[model samples]
Target: MDLESFLLGAVYYYGLFIGLSNFEFDWNTGRVFTSKRSTLYAIGTDSCISVLYIYYWTGNANIVDAIFGKANLLHEYIVVIMTGLRITTGLFTLIHRWYQRCKMMDLTAKVVRMYMARPQVKRMSRWGILIKFISGSVTDGLQMAIILNTMGRVEPQFFLGLGLQYWISVILNMAMVQQYMIMLFVRTQFQLLNSELRQVMEETKEVQLNRRHQGVFMTRCCSLADQLEDIARIQDELQTIVNQLEKVFAIRAAMIYGGYYLSSVGTSYLAYSILKHGYENMNMTLSTVILVFCWCFFYYLDGLLNLYGMLHVQDDYREMMQILGERTLFVGLDVRLDEAFENLNLQLIRNPLEIKVVELYDVTRRSTLAMIGNLITHSIFLIQYDMEHF
Candidate 1:
């Protein structure tokens, strides 16, 4: 096989490796959302292999017509075989991704419902939720566009490999977005809870003056404070994970894309240098072989780099999951209210002034609720409007 043909095949194998790797990771993480992207990547790589085969056959035909009397029968057969393989692979991958997308949509809806049902979260946070959803959707759309463009242009044998690069990029980006949003929500919820707790502490001072409820109230306040501290620590760890992911992505981008382009340019220059030296004995076939070999080597290297990057992204996500799991465990533990509120003063009052507290609470709750409602409604409306316009 010619250099180009060999390179194309190598890229196809590289894509196969990526697909298998992603499948394993997804299965381990229970993240079926990645399966569709992985399938598309495999298909794209397969397409690249087919395109390269066609190019190699065409090149061989031209060479035969120029020198020999007939085209090579083997080359023609290889081209037909590659074309069939490409079509089949592409079709299967497409179907798989489509199915996966539907499943992800359903899962996202369920997650949204669960989030909405959380009583501790303020309604105002809905605005942030909506923003995150919109941003995530936009990011996914951009990623699909990138994949289509890359896959549509790659040579046959190498088609899926190039597409796999974009697939990894899209997945990593989405994961980063999700982690960031989760961190944001965690912080917001902590703040809201803290504020409410402080207000409760202040209001209960008068109630404690005469009420038997002083001990319970004080215990609850201390327990809330402990929960807040635990959440804050988890948030810190999440931020660390986010930072690590960003750094990993930057290094991977440099190594994969930068290295590929640099190597391609260097190899092309080297080929040109050989030609410029007037090496008449070098022949076109030998030069073509060298060029094809170099291209294939570079394609394989790129795939390896992408795989490493993906592993790093997954590691960061796993760390975040660990932190969240730990936080949940801590939250589940019983608080020692007797010990926490032991030093607190509790006063009981016989006839405390009403001070129209109920009216005040009603007005404040109504205004806050209305504000939250407006914010959520406006964000949803804006998202809808943008979707229609786009």
Candidate 2:
């Protein structure tokens, strides 16, 4: 384990803390309403999940002996392994938060820079936080209700059997909230940079007079260059933070998303079996269906929002470059701003600031939209095969 991971182990994670301490946290008066409650929930859920893990680990359990005994041996094994992964991810996220807090440079200054500069950014951050909290609560509550309702029909301890699934979803939900916050942070910083760049360029243009003001123009150019460098440094720092986050979340994302895709396929294959078995229990099958769709919707919406925010940030950067290029047209003053602009542009272009999952694919609008369709196609094939076989 790295120093960070070791440090994380030594510290206790209250509610799987996604170390928001690095950001603008006001511990004095700012209260996290759900923190305490969620910690209790985490403790309870872990207790139940631990029992399942022990069962599987000690060979006291097998695929066919798992909950419901409905799925094939391979399917059951995959579910258990994935569940373990999900729990581990939730804990790691907390550990990561602590590590980032202790070892990394504080991001409160960077986050505050944006919040102070843009009212809209502040408004958006509030709305983003509100949305994540509400949606996360509603989805987890609904899923737990559905699972308990579905399985409670047959077994009273059904909820305990799926405790891992519930908390895993919660952890993933919280992680995505962190991702969204980072995206917002980057966008705001870029927006600030873009605005400042335009202002500087315009000022330079206004100061540009016929030949005699060469020194004044040079001074203005130099000032613009300094500002650009400062903003670029922040932008680079933001990118570094994002790359680090991607590395941290990559495996978790892969497991979560891969599990989503597999569930899509599983639902397709199992729908017929469920319908047949549940013909008399319409409520049960319907709840199961709703639960699956809920998960899909959650993953789809979260992915889209994150992708949109990132693309928006990049678009803002492109617009800044365009403005710089246009302003350079009539500039006969000095070459410093032009050179600085070129250098910054090159850096931006080289980085491109794209997000990815396990370096698998660029997180883009087209790619995200395609995945939904891919799920549909793959699900249909699986359903068709099951229909033929059974």
Candidate 3:
């Protein structure tokens, strides 16, 4: 019911862990306050980890030596590209979150106020959060085991690279999950708005039906109009929330999607090369295969969930529009009702709700399918090249 009640579920801990946010929240006052100590810690930790990751990889010439005897150009390049993506994304998340910390705090305050205003809305589900946390932990553990088994004795550089890679990966993954969860929260708000509108519509129809037998017909109509206006205002606020969150996440969303594509292609190619070369150490080969497969599985699921969350918000918007259209038809010939219906329709039309990635392109079903198609096509090309070459 309150911000603190749900913050523990996912946002707060992940933010603290990944340096996404370092602000303290006052639940009673719905205030988000930041301290110099927390800010310095977030900045220092993120910067040090990033510098260490870069330093470790830059001088290390044996990156692929653990997996391949001779350097496979493609595999090495893929590692470089993937590492670059991870670092770029990790740094961007940290920097951008800091740059937008004030705006984010304001948005958090808005969300808290919205929730306070509507206690009927469902609180964040700790069960879902627990399941996700457990799943991620298990996946990370499996990845570490597989990598250690394949690479054998973890040299300092190898350990450093692997540890840093895991750090960046965790940061990006947590950011992705947080964005998805916030969008889900917004979708729920839209849903609640639609439900309230439906109730008002039903009540209006009942009042109309009893108009002949009742004396407070005009009074009831006026009350319904007030309810409609209140719902409109809520919808407007929800839209603002969506837009503000978009600013917070647009670039990161694009980077995350791009990271997924690169990961899938790189992993697919690695699997092909491993198969072709047929490493003499059977255990190493098997471990490498499992490691690649596990990474692919987690990335695939992460991308799917993000895409679904975006699409679901779009679906809710469409449903809200449909309900508004229905209400328009039943508004009769009253000038006030007509204006209200027209204004709501026009507002939706002019400023439609859209979840965008990269700040320019809207994430729709068609676009998402196309993205998947492109990923598959690229993976196939890379796999074919690996077969013919390495």
Number of the predicted model whose TM-score against the real structure is largest: 3
The true-versus-predicted C-alpha distance at residue 190 of model 1, in Å, is 0.8
User: Tens digits of per-residue lDDT for model 2 on 1-390?
Assistant: 443223222222422442322222332233223355544554555455556655645653332243446544444444565566666666555445544543222444444454555445544355555555456556667767765765655544344446555655666665665666667667766777778878877776676654466676677778878887886786787777667666756766676666666665665555655565553332335556677667657655665576677778768767866876775466565677777777877777788677788998776668867987998898777656656654
lDDT of 3 at 345: 81
**lDDT (Cα, 0-100) at 229 in candidate 3:** 82
Across residues 166-219, which tens digit of lDDT does each residue of candidate 3 receive?
A: 777777777877776567667778878788888877887787567773447767
User: Order of candidates by TM-score, top first?
Assistant: 3, 2, 1
Task: Give RMSD (Å) of candidate 1 vs. truth.
Answer: 22.0
What C-alpha RMSD separates each model from the true structure?
Answer: 22.0, 7.4, 3.0
- Candidate 1 lDDT by residue in tens digits, 1-390: 543234323432443453421221221223324466666675665456446544545553332223212323432333344333333433343334344545433443333343344434435444544544444445445545544543443445444444444454433333334333433444444445345434434433433453466576556556545654544443344344433333323323333333333334434433443444333332234444444454445443433333333333334333433333322222222244322222111110222111111233221234535644754564455335434542
lDDT of each: 0.39, 0.60, 0.72
Model 3 stretches with alpha carbons more than 4 Å out? 1-10, 124-139, 143-151, 213-215, 279-285, 331-335
Better of 2 and 3 by TM-score: 3
Candidate 1 wrong stretches, greater than 4 Å = 1-124, 151-153, 208-390
Clash number by candidate, in order: 24, 0, 0
